[model samples]
Each structure stands twice: as C-alpha cells, then as structure tokens.
Target: MRDSFDLIGIVMPSLLQGATVTLQVAAQAGLLGLVVALVVGSLRTTENRLLRFPLTVYVEFFRGTSAFVQLYWAYFALPMIGVRLDPLQAGILVLALNVGAYGSEVVRGALTAIPRGQLEACRALGIPTWVAYVKVLIPQAMQRVVLPMGNLAIDLLKGTSLLSAIAVTELAFAARQTVSAFGNPMLIFGLVLLMYLVLAAPIAAGARYLNDRTKRYVA
Candidate 1:
C-alpha cells in the first residue's frame, strides 16, 4: 500500500511533464489544421479547377491514408529525402495534415450551407468577393462549423497518442516507460486513461456550450 503510493508519487511528475508535451503538440497541430482546412475548404468551393483540383487531391490523399503511416513517413522517409524532422515536428505535421483533411470537409459544408441569396445581396450592395466572404459568408459559416470543429479538436487530442510510436515522449510514451520501469501496467495505464478523460472533458463541455449559443443566436 505504502509502496504503491510511493511509486505513484515518483511516476506522477514524469507523466505530467509528458502530458504537457502532449497538450502542446495537440494545440499547435489543431491550430495549424484549422488554417489548412479553411484554405483547402475555400478552394474546394471555388469554380477554378486549377486551384480546386490539387487541393482536392491533397484532402483526399490525407483522408485516405492512415495517420500512423503518415507519421512514420515523415519521421523516417523525409530524412531519406534530405528533410530531417525531429520527433515533435513529424508528429505535429502528420496530425495537422490528417485532421485538416477531415476538417476541410466540415468547413466546405458550412460554407456551402450559406444561402445563395445572402451572397447575391452582398454582390448587389457592391461588396467585393473578398469582403463578402470576410463580413457576410465566413461569420455565418463559422457559427455553423463550431460544433464540427470542436469535434475535430477532440479527435486531434486523442490522435496525439499516436505520436508515441515515433518517440515523441508524450503522455502515452511516458506511461509506457513507467510501466516498463515499475512493471505496473494497470496502474500506469489507468492513470493515463484518467488523464486523457480529464483533458477531454473541458473540450467536450466547451463544444456543447458553443453549440447551444450558436443555436440561440440562429433562432
């Protein structure tokens, strides 16, 4: 009993440190993914085949492939091609690209859901296409996308665990190391599960809050 408590005390600090890395990677990747989604989504809605076609290919390729394979390629294959990325860099890049592909569809759907009349109204008012998108289209679309984006954020959070395979030293990797050292798989992994739940709960709550607020606003 006392020994178990002592073991936990020794392990907790390392786990927390790794948790910080996990959060940092997820947050950075999520932000980058949103940017990619916005760009790719907007391009996809345009009539320009030149611009849309390549973006479509990018979205499809990432969506179709396994994120684990993507991470491995970035970590291992990129170096062979003279692009050496550290574990963290490879993890973030793979995560951002993977989630961005899915989020692009969400963004495209949101933007497409806007009424054509609203765009016509903006055009009749002499609004430039860029201005119309910025002032009228994007705001409304963003409101609709909030819930989906929140879901993507949560997915990205869970996806960060995959980084452990690349030696990113994030939470799962830390837990694995602890298990190896202490030979207490149940305790270590149980704590890891609890920590993930703790991290995810607030994100889920915030998403629900935003969803409610959006509904009220729309009503």
Candidate 2:
C-alpha cells in the first residue's frame, strides 16, 4: 500500500505535466482541424469542378492514408525536402490534418443532407449562393455536425498520445518515461488511462452542451 502511494506521488506530477501538453496539442489541432474541415469540406461541395477537383483529392488522400505513417512522413520526411517542423508542430499538424480529413466528411455530409427544397426556396427568393450557404445551409449543417464533431474532438484528444513517438513529451511519453524509471507498467499505465479519461470528459461534455443548444435549430 505504501509502495503504491509512493508510486502515485512520484508519478502524478509527471503525468500531470504530460497531460497539459496533451491538452495543448489537442486544443490547437482541434481548432485547426475545424477550419480545415469547413474550408475543404465546404469547397468540395461547390459546383465549380476546377475548385472541387483539388479539394476532393486532398480529402481523399488524407482520409485514405494511415495517420501514423502521415506523422512519420511529416516529422521525418518533410525535413528532407526543406519543410521542417519541430516535434510538437509536426504532431499538431498531422493530427489536425488527419482529423480534419475525417471532420470534412462530417461537414460535407451535414451540408449535403440539408433538404433540396430549402435550397430551391433560397434560389426562388433571389438569395445569392454564398448568402444561402451562410444563412441557411451552414447553420443547419453546423447543428447537424455538432455531435459528430464532438466525437472527432475526442478522437483528436486521444490522438495526441501518438506524439510520444516524435518525443513531444505528451501524456503517453511521460507515462513511458515513468515506467522505465520506476518499473511499474501496470500501475503507470492504469494512471495513464485515468488521466486520458479525465482529459476526454470535458470534450464530451462540451459536445453535449453544444448539441443541446443546437437541437432547436435542428428541429
């Protein structure tokens, strides 16, 4: 019992620090991913084939590839071609782009799911295409996408653990370091899981809150 307590005492602080980094990576990546999703997903829906073609390729490429390989490519390969990023930067970029690809699908699906009648009504009323998207399609789509976005947010949060591979010192990395020194994999990893759960709770709650707020709009 005393040994367990001692392990907790030694490990908790390091884990907390790692959790902080994890949150930072997740937050930045989530925000960037939202932007990418909105832009790429929205553009891919456009009537202009010139515009849509490239964006379609982007969405497909990111969505189809393995995120783990993408991370290694971003961190290890990009530098060879003169596009170099620090470990944290690469981790955030890869995660944002990966989740952004997935999020874009959510955005596209939500937007496309809006009834054709509403769009026809907008056109009949002489609403510009952009205005229609902004005032009509997007707002509805946002409400629809909120729950899925929440799930993506949690996925992004969990994905931050992969940053340990690049030595970003996020939660999993910290856990690994603790385990190496203290020789307690089960205890260390159990605590790691708990910390991840703690980190994920807020994202889940925020998603539910946003979903509730948007329910009336969706209805």
Candidate 3:
C-alpha cells in the first residue's frame, strides 16, 4: 500500500501539471459562458420576438443535448464538414456553449429579479439603459446569485474531464495515461479526485465569502 502510494505520488506532479490544462479549459469556458448567458438572458427579458426567437432555439438546442455530443460535434463533425478545430479549441467551445445554455436561464432570472423600480429610477435619472444594467441591475443580480454561478464554474471544472475523451491532455487524460502504465487504477483515480477537489474548493470558498461580504453590504 505504501509502495502504491509512493507510485501515485511519483506521478502526481505530472497530474498536477495537467490540472493547469483543466483550469484553463474551465476558466475560459465559464467566462465565455457567462458572456453568452448575459446576452441571451437580456434578450429573454426583452419584448423583441426577433432577438428572442433565435436565442430561444439556441438555448433549447444546447440545453436539450448532451454536452458530450456537442464535444464530439466540435472535435469530429466540424472537421468532416471542412471546418477543423484543434482539441483545445473544440473543448473550450463546446464547454462554453453547453454551460452557456444553462447559464442563460440563471442570468435571465437574475436580471428579472431586480426590482422594476430600479429600472424606472435609472430612466428617470436620465441614465442610459446599458449604464443602468451595468451599474445597477447586473451588480444586484450578481450579488443575489453568486452561488449558482460558482456552481456552474465548478461544474465546468469537472466537465473538463470530458475533454480527455477527445484526447486532450488534461487531468483526466493524464490520470488514464498514468493508470495504464502503472497498473494501479485506484491510486490514479484517487489522485485525480484530489486534484479536482483542490481546484473546486477555492471557488466554493470564494462564493461563500462573497455571499457573506455582500450580505454585509446589503445590511
């Protein structure tokens, strides 16, 4: 057991290095997803059928499908159609699209949750709609639901494991490679789990801290 642990430790640094890849994927995906979410959410709030119609279809299509299928489409289908993408690009794109679908709803709901009076006040004060949204609505909405976004961030972090299926050399790929060579699957998986916890714990803590601090502000 001690020898097995030592073997796991020997390769752990390599696995940790792979975590950098995981972090890169998740960070890019979450940021892009939030951007997508904000756009779609705002559209959903508006009365425009033109903007709402296409955005609805996009959100539904993404939300309806498995993220793995999207990843496959990115890595495989696009190439078959003569639009090739590298694994990293495909991974990030698919992750962003998938998370964005769900994030859009969160964003829409958050945007809606802001009091109507705030919008009216902003308008009466001669503030631009964009300024009102940025300065007042988005700040309050973000404060109201930091936890959910944090969960999405954590979800994307875990979802990076799926990129391994596309031969991306992220943590999941590194774990599989080490396990194959070492013949100790348990130790390899344990290390992988640990690495995921290491990545996720801080985001969770930060979410809680922000929540607490924001409550202090509101109070």
Candidate 4:
C-alpha cells in the first residue's frame, strides 16, 4: 500500500498533464464540431439537391465509419498523398468530424420540428429569409437541441481517449505509460477511469442544467 501510494504520487503529475491535453482536444473539437453541425445541418434543409446531396454524403460517410479508422487515416494514410498532419491535429480533426456528423442530425431534427406555419407567418410579415432564421427559427431550434449537443460534447470528451492510439499523449496514453513503468495496471488504470469520471461529471451536470432551463423557458 505504501509503495502503491508512492507510485501514484509519482504518476499523478504526468497523468494530470495528459488530462490537460485531453481537455484541450475535447474542447476545441467540440467547438469545431458544433460549427460543422450548424452549417451542414442548415445546408441539408435546403431544397437544392446539389447542396443537400453532397452534405448528405458527408454526414453519412462520417457516421457510417469508425472514428479510429478516420484518425488512423488522417495520421497515417494522408502522408502518402502529400497531406501530413501531426497527431494532435489529426486527433482534433477526426473527433470534430465524427461528433459533427452525429450532431448534424440533432440540429436537423430540431430545426425540422419547428412548425411550418411559424415560417409562413414570418413570410406573411415580409421578413427576409435570413432574418427569419436568425431572429426566430434558429433561437428556438437551438433551445431544443441544447441537451443533445451537451450529450454529444460528453461523447466527444470520452472519445478523446482514442487519440492515445495515434500517439497524441492524452490521458489514456499517459496512463498506459505509467502502467508500463510501474507494473501496476490496476492502480494506474483504475485511477485513469476515475480521472475520466472527474472530467465527465461537469459536462453531464451542465447539460442537465441547460435542459431544465430550456424546458422552463419553453414553458
């Protein structure tokens, strides 16, 4: 037990450093993913088949594939085509694209759930299309989608662990390194699991809070 405590004391700092990297990747990827979700989701709602069809393909391709494969492709395969990205960049890009593909559906469903009559009402009032979307439609749609977006953010946070496979040096990678050195798999990995719970707790709480607030506001 004394040796285990000493080992933990030695490993915790490195683990924390890796956790910081994990947080950074997840935060940046989540923000980028939200932007992708908004643009792709909005494009998908248009009547222009030209725009919609390609966006549809983008969404489906990401959703259908494994994010691990995507990350590996970006980090490994892209170099052959004269496109090389470092591990951090590759990890962020893959996480963003993967979560964005899933979140796009949330955006689309939220927007589509709005009553057509509401849009027609804006039209009757001679509101410009963009203005109607900005002032009325998007705000309401955003409220409805907030909870799902939060859920996506949590999933993205968890997904950052996969970055270890590509040598991103995030928490999981740090834990693996510690385990190899200390030869205490249970102590290292169990702590790693607890670290993940620590990271995930606030996101889940924030989402629940937003969900309640949105429900109250909608009421």
How do the residues 47-124 of candidate 3 rate in per-residue lDDT, one tens digit apiece? 999989999999999999999999998898998889999999999999998899889988888777878999899999
Root-mean-square deviation of every model: 2.2, 2.3, 2.4, 2.1
lDDT by candidate, in order shown: 0.90, 0.90, 0.88, 0.91
Which residue runs does candidate 4 get wrong by more than 4 Å?
A: 122-136
TM-score of 4: 0.91
Q: Could you tell me the TM-score of candidate 2?
A: 0.90
Score candidate 1 by TM-score against the native: 0.91
Q: What is the lDDT of residue 192 in candidate 1?
A: 93
Off by over 4 Å in 3: 121-136, 216-219
Cα error of candidate 3 at position 153, Å = 0.3
Q: How displaced is residue 43 in candidate 4, in Å?
A: 1.0
Q: What local lDDT score does residue 134 receive in model 1, on the 0 to 100 scale?
A: 82
lDDT of 2 by residue, 11-93 (tens): 89999999999989998999999999999888888899999988888889988888889999999999999998999999999
Badly placed stretches (over 4 Å) of model 1 are 121-136
Better structure of 2 and 4 per TM-score: 4
Q: In candidate 2, how many Å is residue 35 off?
A: 0.9
Instruction: Report clashes for each candidate as comma-separated counts.
Output: 0, 0, 0, 0
Candidate 3, poorest ten consecutive residues by summed lDDT: 210-219
Which clashing pairs does model 2 show?
Answer: none
Candidate 1 root-mean-square deviation in Å: 2.2
Put down candidate 4 lDDT per residue, 1-219, tens digits, no spaces.
999899999999999999999999999999999899999987888899999998999999999999999999999999999998999999999999999999989989997889998889899999999998887887778688988888898899999999999888999999999888888899999999999999899988998887777664331
Over the full model, what C-alpha lDDT does candidate 2 score relative to the true structure?
A: 0.90
